[model samples]
Target chain A: MEPIVAYSLVLSAVLFTMGVLAVLARRNPIIMFMGIELMLNAANLAFIAFSRHLDKLDGQVIALIFMAVAAAEVAIGLAIIVSIYRYRRDVDVDAVNVLRG
Target chain B: MNVIELIVFIAAAALALVGAAGMVMSRNPVHSALFLIANFFALAVIFLLLSAPVLAALQVLVYAGAIMVLFLFIIFFFVQPGQKHLYVYSLPWQTFFSGILVIVLICILVLGLYMGGVFTAEEHVQSAAMKVEELTSPQALGSALFSRYLLPFELTSLLLLAAMLGAVVLARKEGRGDMEEKD
Candidate 1:
């Protein structure tokens, strides 16, 4: 096995784990969004690695789609965050407990 | 892998991990954003090394450049300087569960990759070299993206349009008279 593939996969896994941790541990919405970006980037890394390993263009194309989707997500997510901030003057996830039972 | 390749891989991996950890551990949102940018750049380097130059360029252009600037703008808009001291980890159980989850995920991924024979170093090196020869150039990527995946490509544009409209609607402020009339 190529050490590069192994190393990249391991790095992607670790980065994904960190993103999950950020989403779970952080109370701020923007930070959580950043976490999601990290996870997306991790997936992109894995995709590019596999694409190289298999000598395929499909993975790279899919990665391109993922980037587009991530960009859209950031746009909508930030807009929602800004709206929430306007309403409550805070972006803390715990504070926006309107959905809580 | 050659010594130079090994060294580069090690450096990129280390930088990526450090950036990720720094993003997660930083209390201030701005600092976390900066760390994430660092991670994005390091990941771009890895993409280049993987023989996907188009993806590397996109990673820097879109992820590191556009998305990060948007994040920073949102952070500045929503979070004032005095309000920067918000709770990062308000729950102890959250941290405990996150730790366990990280361990389980890493174990599963490492074991799965090993069992799948992905670490067969020589074969990987050979294939990787071949891939580098075939190197996914921007023109090739555009050809595949447009010809093979045309529908999804068009749909992504539609998705971007919707996202733009949604953002505008969500962020637009109504007239004060409208709120007073509703009240």
Candidate 2:
């Protein structure tokens, strides 16, 4: 692989790992949502890099779809967070245990 | 590649990593959101370097512009004034296990890349000679998105509509009160 591709892939991997750490370690819903976004972005980077590597347009198209899906996810997720906060007065994942038996 | 391209790539990659680290390490949700926006910007530059200007533009417009704004709004709306303990990491075991998982994943990625001949000098020449005339332009991407991927494109629009309606229903205060009164 080219140096650029290698660098991008490594960066994507590092970012994805950091995102996982954020999602696992943080209790705040917003921060966890941001982590998910970071992972998606990392995947997008890998997609673009491979698309360039293979000289194809499919990867870019897929990346576009991923972005659209991410936007939709954020819309629904934030709305859920807001509703949860309205009833519970906090967005911490551990604090909202209404479903716990 | 050239000296300038290498330098740019290194700078962008460094910025992206820093932003990612900051997003994970910061205690303030607003700060984390800002860091994520910076990371998205750096990723857009990297996308440009990868010869996908359309993706780069979309990264800026969608992720940095729209999504980050939404995040900031939600952060300010939900977080109360004078709330000191905004971020509490109460799960140490989860963090420890996640740390182990991250290390393992990184090891696997590096090993896979090395074994896949990604670092080989032979593939560099082939990658350099790749045809740029087809996949690098916005027009080409538009054609592919419309003709070849028409179903997915239309489906995405439907998904967006559903998400919008769901957001409205979930966040509506009167709807919540009606459910409470009925119960």
Candidate 3:
């Protein structure tokens, strides 16, 4: 692989790990949501890297779709977080355990 | 192999790493949002390097500009300031397990990519590099997005519409009959 592709892949790996750590460790739902975004971005990076490496436009097309999905996810996710806060006055993932509330 | 490309890539990669670290470690959600914005910008630079200038522009305009602004607005409007410091490293076991998971995940991803021959494949690099400009040109991407990928493009619009409706419904105030009917 080219140096650029290799380095970009490594960076994507590292960023993805950090995002997983954030999702698992953070108590706040918003931070966890950010971690999810980080993971998605990392995936997009890998897609772009492979797209460049393979000389294919398919990967870039998939990355574009990923971006659209991510946007929709964020919108619905933030709305759910707001709804959770409305009921309990807090947005801690650990605190909001029960489904009924 | 070019010196200028290497330098730019290294700088952007470092910025991206630092932003990820800060976003993960920051106590305040607002600060985390800001750090993530910086990370998105760095990723945009890297995207440009990868010859996907259109993706880079969308990365800046959509991720950094629109999504992050929404995040910051949520942080300001809903998230309480006093709640920031209350959850500092509260889950030790969760952190420990997460650290293990991350290490395993990185190892698997990197080794899998390397051993899968991704790092050794060099036959197409020259040809691919030569076509970099054409790959990301508006005409090329637009034709592909509109022709071959038309179905997905249309589906994405539907998904966005559904999400908008969902958000509006979920965030709306609950009327007196809203919960009573469920009970």
Chain B superposition TM-score per model = 0.85, 0.87, 0.88
What is the per-residue lDDT of model 3 for residues B1-183, given as tens digits with 9 covering 90 to 100?
589989999999999999999999999899999999999999999999999999999999999999999999988998778665332336658878888888899899999988877678465545554688787787888899999999999999999999999999989878877665763
Model 1: interface root-mean-square deviation in Å: 2.0
Of 1 and 2, which scores higher on lDDT? 2
Top DockQ: which candidate number?
A: 2
Error of 1 at A95 (Å): 2.5
Question: What's the DockQ for every one of the candidates?
Answer: 0.70, 0.72, 0.69
Better of 1 and 3 by DockQ: 1
Which has the better TM-score: candidate 2, or candidate 3? 3
- Please provide TM-scores computed only on chain A for all of the candidate models, following their numbering: 0.94, 0.95, 0.97
User: Comparing 2 and 3 by lDDT, which wins?
Assistant: 3
Candidate 2 chain B has its poorest 10 consecutive residues by lDDT at: B121-130
User: What local distance difference test score does each model get?
Assistant: 0.84, 0.87, 0.89
lDDT of 1 by residue, B77-105 (tens): 77877575343446658778877887887
Q: What is the CAPRI rating of model 3's predicted complex?
A: medium
Cα lDDT of candidate 3 equals 0.89
Q: Each model's fnat?
A: 0.82, 0.82, 0.74
- CAPRI grade, predicted model 1: medium
Worst 10 residues of 3 chain B by lDDT: B83-92
